[model samples]
Target: MQHLLGLYRASERDIALILQEAAVLKPALLSSPPQSFSFLNGKTVVLAFFENSTRTRTSFELAVRRLGGSILNFSAATSSLQKGETLLDTIANIEAMQVDAFVIRHGESGAAEIVAKHTRKVVINAGDGMHEHPTQALLDMFTLHETFGRLSGLHILILGDILHSRVARSNIFGLRKMRASVSVCAPPTLLPVGIEHFGVKVFADISQALEQCDAAIVLRLQLEREAAGFIPTLREYNTFFALTDEALSKVSHKIFVLHPGPVNREIELSSVVTDRDDTSGKSESLILRQVTNGVAVRMAVLKVLLYDRA
Candidate 1:
């Protein structure tokens, strides 16, 4: 694959290769002995993020550094995009500098694809509007498989703004490809039209969704949706969709919770689950593990993209 624009086009073998590479690298790179990598040696990767980010950008940077690559963080706010320079023109200018690859995050859907078409370098979509976050889904899948030892036959419920979450969309594409059952729960307004066409059941009630799924991937409310009046209020949204302490207390089975955060505490998830992330293998939250796995998955992705092999 010349570019990882979304999971919708990634072959099942491609996904497995990345996950398997990450499984091997995670322990080796994160261990006490800290086995290092040089897959990115003598290569320069550009972080061209048009939107604000925390985990994705940080983890990608750490992943590149760990692989001995040089970093160039490009901010759209400070770049010529502010002065009416077209997106393609700006990307062309950057491409002319001989960068090896681009990690792009943009508020516009298909932005990465456009950049890829204009540039000769490999493009990894960190995120693209509400379309997809491929690496996030890869890392999320790695976390799920690492914890459960398998993804087949496991029911994973994605709870929250499916209409606006790139992470949720990517996860749906990836999990379904891996033969895992997927479902989504959200307020009527927060759910997109024909989302059921994605081959996942849609539930208006969170409790019903939780009851059927083995793991819940809770998503944060898109603040943009609230401003556009997608829902009645935060309190009302929380009442229907929030994974609160009281909500999970009723489920008898062992179910885990994951979030691609900046979590809205007491909203998407309560403090009880978010605050008690532990290493005892008993904490319901796999939030931090997702963050840690992000780096390894990104490293594996770079290895594959740059070297064309895992």
Candidate 2:
């Protein structure tokens, strides 16, 4: 198989096969964890993050370690990247280190594709601007697979910041590829042009989008867009797009809530819903499960792309 650059770029059969593999591997990874990786054990994975992230960075690091591989961290502030070293030159130096994988996050669109073209090592798109967050979509599909037992015909609603959310773009592709129906719920300003072309239904109102959906993935309102002139104010966006408990109550009982991390509580999601444990009080929230599944799904990705002898 070729490198997985975007979820929608994958064939339907391939997506189904990965989903099936994830189902079988999730229990194995969670129970009898591998001491390290069988194939990646001595391999070095480079984490080149040019943007801010807590979940994607930490999850990738944990996934590498759990697979028995090591990582070399690279941040722009402490590296030659700050001194104007080109992305190509940096990747070349890292490639010379015999790295096995390059998990990259950059603020520019198509940055990962550029690195994929220039580098000899495997390139995983952690995120590249508003272009795509392929792994996030993978983990989300994992989470849904775990919770719902299937992907085809599932109704998923993605809420907020669609104009600048790599998550939305990737999920649109990932979900559609898996034969799921997808909808984007956001204010007009927060949505990008030509969203319908991606094969997702669009909703200008959050309440309408939530109606009878199987799951809802809420995206935090990206403040950076304000500077980029994509949006005007947090106050207005919150008033319109924020997913309060009140908003969640409007959705069907079967609809599960999901969010990618650094959740702006009361901004993108209600703390009451996201922060709450189940009846046990000690049980983990779905957000925590999302994080946990991130590692396993990434491990599956690494194993399939880097190790599978097929």
Candidate 3:
């Protein structure tokens, strides 16, 4: 509970508590007048993003301001890392400057763990390379719970790029912790070795996978990881694997579609489903709702971590 490193290390009770706190904070923080709570009033958080991001970075920034906190946006490119300074040295320097916590996204797996161990300050992993994005998984669960009223017994299918997805790994950990049945569908190349040991069913056919699940978390094809010949070709992967409207038609019940975005409009899902006018903020895709909940969830997490709740 002291550090939000990864959901796999967190208890079911802890996840439930954070989600509960988010539910309470969401209404006021997202209201028309947008009430701001000052629980984090004097704390300073550093967004130590070593990798580029859109949703995760922006939402954390939004959450920090909404909670009346201060944030410093850190860039590895501009920092001493470019000048041969070590990560530990950089963190030591930042911690000396009134920083209370760090929300870090790094390109290496276990990088957050290294920082969490190095500093006494709270560490929240924004993301770690192909390891786990705990907050993204938490927010995805938050969106699902908002729509379904619960996580238990709801069969969720996580489709795509499993072997390289930190989001997928975290989701599998979290959803299973909440008592929800988790399954994955991906090309055999994209699926990880011994994934079933994590307590999930695996499927090859996307249609059959769609038939059994109530909701599907569509993952973007991690094109960055494709250089190692994980698949035959990107075109072949998209043609056969992408979650399209035609694929959803085979299922009878509504299969809520979600993607921890920067959605690949061309490869992961068709534009028709993602291109809908959702200005009312009630998109059935639940994509936009996930973004909104991210701020609330991060706010709840910051409140818990920085409030001396240990």
Top candidate on lDDT is 3
User: What C-alpha lDDT do the candidate models reach, one value each?
Assistant: 0.89, 0.79, 0.89
> Could you give candidate 3's per-residue lDDT for residues 77-182 as a string of tens digits?
8889999999999999999997899999999999999999999999999999999999999999999999999999999999999998999999999999999999
Q: Higher lDDT: candidate 2 or 3? A: 3
Whose lDDT is higher: candidate 1's or candidate 3's? 3
Tens-digit lDDT track of model 2 for 1-310: 5466777577776666666665665675666644455557878888899998888898888777776788899987789888989999989987897888889899999998888888767888899988999889888888887888888889998988888788988889888888899999887877788888888899887778778487888888756766876667776677777776666566555457788887887777768767765644311247788887887777777767777732
- Model 2's alpha-carbon lDDT is 0.79
Q: Which ten residues in a row have the lowest lDDT in candidate 1?
A: 274-283
| TM-score of each predicted structure versus truth | 0.96, 0.90, 0.95
lDDT of 3 at 4: 95
TM-score of 2: 0.90
